[model samples]
Target chain A: MDVKPARRTDSHFVASLEKAMRVLEAFGPEQARLGLTELSIETGLDRSSVQRLTTTLHQLGYLDKDATTKRFSPSIRMTELANRYLWSDDLVKSAMPRLIDLRQALGETINFSRLDGTDIVYTARLPSSRTSYAAMIIGRRVPALNTSSGRVMLALREPGERQRAIEEWPMQRFTSQTTMDREAVKRLVEEAAETGYSIAENELQMNELALAVAVNRNGEPGGAIHCSVSGTVWTRERLREDVMPRLRDVANAIG
Target chain B: MDVKPARRTDSHFVASLEKAMRVLEAFGPEQARLGLTELSIETGLDRSSVQRLTTTLHQLGYLDKDATTKRFSPSIRMTELANRYLWSDDLVKSAMPRLIDLRQALGETINFSRLDGTDIVYTARLPSSRTSYAAMIIGRRVPALNTSSGRVMLALREPGERQRAIEEWPMQRFTSQTTMDREAVKRLVEEAAETGYSIAENELQMNELALAVAVNRNGEPGGAIHCSVSGTVWTRERLREDVMPRLRDVANAIG
Candidate 1:
């Protein structure tokens, strides 16, 4: 006879509310509009549960249903949550003007990202003349141990924590040039701690060179200011002499 | 004898889930952080309910709690929902290239807004050199009758729907120059129908001039492309001659 564990339940946790969020979270770039059955499959909820949650979300103006197809998608009202978050975030509010100034001055894609657990989530983005649609969207996350912004942010953490992240945090080979060796990554982090900036060449995107400087809030690392340019058009020496000072200035000015 | 209506209930609707959303929706620019009592007041829920919802949201990564104060605020993960919305929106995805081109060409603030009920919600925003933080934020709503983008979108609707909107939708006098009279607003909508573009000067902002053209999807009015410039620097005649054609081109280029 096999012993089974009881389902986890807590007095303070609302399981149904989490289920409802799963319905909304089911929508992504690949799974945009989903029929009830597809939603159930994607969310791993029973058909009946999916139906009730989708209905409730639709009625609350968070999800939109197509009248003809009966498929469900996230409504524009969903942006309201993001709007609230952006407005309430003091770091993002203070960084916007400086980010815009940097964008105008550099004529390259500028991004502001903050450390979230083991990832860096892009809080704001200012696209240049040739930026792609995918790059322009906010809220995209990248591994903290594999990118310039992430390394810069990690460089400011306590030594013990930074060591733990370098050893334990996951790293993906986003491109052929991505440094997968732990010793190489550790040296990069140490260099960032010494120089106050980090550079990753062709790490995330092919032919892209990224430079980042950490933004401090009350003497703690809050986020990083990043500028990415085509590796074909920029060299490390030129980037350091010409762009590093401006990036440092903007990052320092941010809260 | 007094009779009170019983609380409405439906099998398909999850009341607890809606209540959970109410907790998240309570945070705004002014009400960023909220204690248990404040959240209960703002959400109109009992203390215990607020606590459960906040705890669930915090554990689920939607809300953040201060270490010492124990107050709750929305977390950066909230942007993930907005990200899903933007990625799944067909109108926004198709309009990005044209909107970006228009922004670069004109060197002013560019917005893409879609009609949602009686209001227009800005789904995307590209800032100019002088654009403010408030102006750059996406997901802000403006009335359909007062804004140039709103009026252009309204102009493309059926006459009956248009009439109802002009008469029934709420209007706010954001600036002294806002057109408050229903008949005058009707004329502006009619003019938009005739001219294929609409312009509103000093309506929402004191020194701002806005011009918009509707973007069509499958031969139906989908959204609008907007360009706003300093009123002092632009005249109606100059805007019409220099900017209207470019706006029209971009609007037409979008799906």
Candidate 2:
């Protein structure tokens, strides 16, 4: 998912947060440093507004101003904030060893993602380290239904969950092969649950094939973990015969 | 440093970002799955605010909501943001290999940082792989005068430049070793420029000895690179004699 945050709460304070986000977004792939005038121009706010925000931010550790140069730059407060967000999650870190093992054993990109309402969001990833995917960056999020990882996660959701997701938002196809019909998605969820695994071939149209399984922790469905491979590797029969058992074993081990 | 940005830009926006941050933060070392009301209680935000923020965040890739259960959880957007940050600096990435090589040869925590006005922001770090230091999270920023890295960068600043930083904000005594006199600090900067490096012992009170060299690029001192050893490891003399050459070489290579 391009890592854009969803819309914000309409609290009286939302505008301030939006402004702050604009300032943060203002510093991107380029333009790492700014003077107050530069930030105001970039953010489309008056200098007074930018100055007020920056002053508070500087005090709080988000932005640091050079005492001599009068230039402003980001501070370690960004990491501190990110850590406050989800850095404390052991689940993501806990999956590291197994993710490393899965990457080595399967030679495919591996991911661990959790369910967010109807969609799935990845929390941990071990790129096919020896031969990186060259496609996925570590933290990008994708649809829960379109990916093998998503399908595996969706399978574990309670029965009405499938209908709700489809109802809440009709499937938006990620690729030509992505399923859009509610009935088809429902069937996929059901079958995958019964089989204890999910497989998708050329569905993501990265032309990747994937096998996925879910983790059960303390009787709760944790999330899905999947192994993905490019087109050259997949044959349907191989997925069923060669990959499914090992995928199941990995799931069991995590459970 | 914490991975999350705690101090976002304007205080007005603090609520929005904090709410969004809290929604992600809601998933902690534990408590991965949280129903809307539960989320409200956990964050001390109202149910409606929590619900709205969670819904928007879900759409934006930061949060995932389970439709059937109406619970909220963290999405992979956290990792995506982290990776986005890691790759933000092309210059730092290119310098990483040489930085690592120098760290190993020097047997100290080697670091490179850019001057962001008054603060020295660390863009790259090669910690002693064989040992651990206090805190060395990449993207962390530190005070310029308080650190050898900062002092080295400050040494290259023009007379007006160094004068401005001190005048804008008088130096605060961060540690027993921090020099409080502006005139004294200025003289030290002059000495550092003449000698081509700066050294500080127990300056930040970590009881460490450090040496730093400024990387002058295009007739401007762009940044500083430093190597540090614990007082427990290198006697002041050994550090002065043994470590200075490696630091100079590393800085030269960087320039």
Q: Which stretches of candidate 1 lie above 4 Å from their native place? A: A1-8, B1-8
Q: What is the lDDT of candidate 1?
A: 0.85
B1-255: candidate 2 lDDT, tens digit per residue: 222455544343344555665555566535766888788887888988887677666655456667798776665445445444444544554556666566546646777777765677665544443223223433444667676677667767787877776556435565687777767666767778788888877676556677888887765777777777787767867876887777677667767
State the RMSD for candidate 2.
9.6
lDDT of 1 by residue, A1-255 (tens): 011122126778788877887788888888889999999998789999999999888877888899999999889987778888888898888888888778777778899899998998888988765666667878777789999999988999889999999999989898888989999999999999999999999888788888999987776789998988988889988888888899898887774
Model 1, B12: alpha-carbon shift in Å?
A: 0.7
Worst 10 residues of 1 chain A by lDDT: A1-10
Best by lDDT: 1
Clashes of 1: 0
RMSD in order of candidates: 3.8, 9.6
Candidate that would win on TM-score: 1
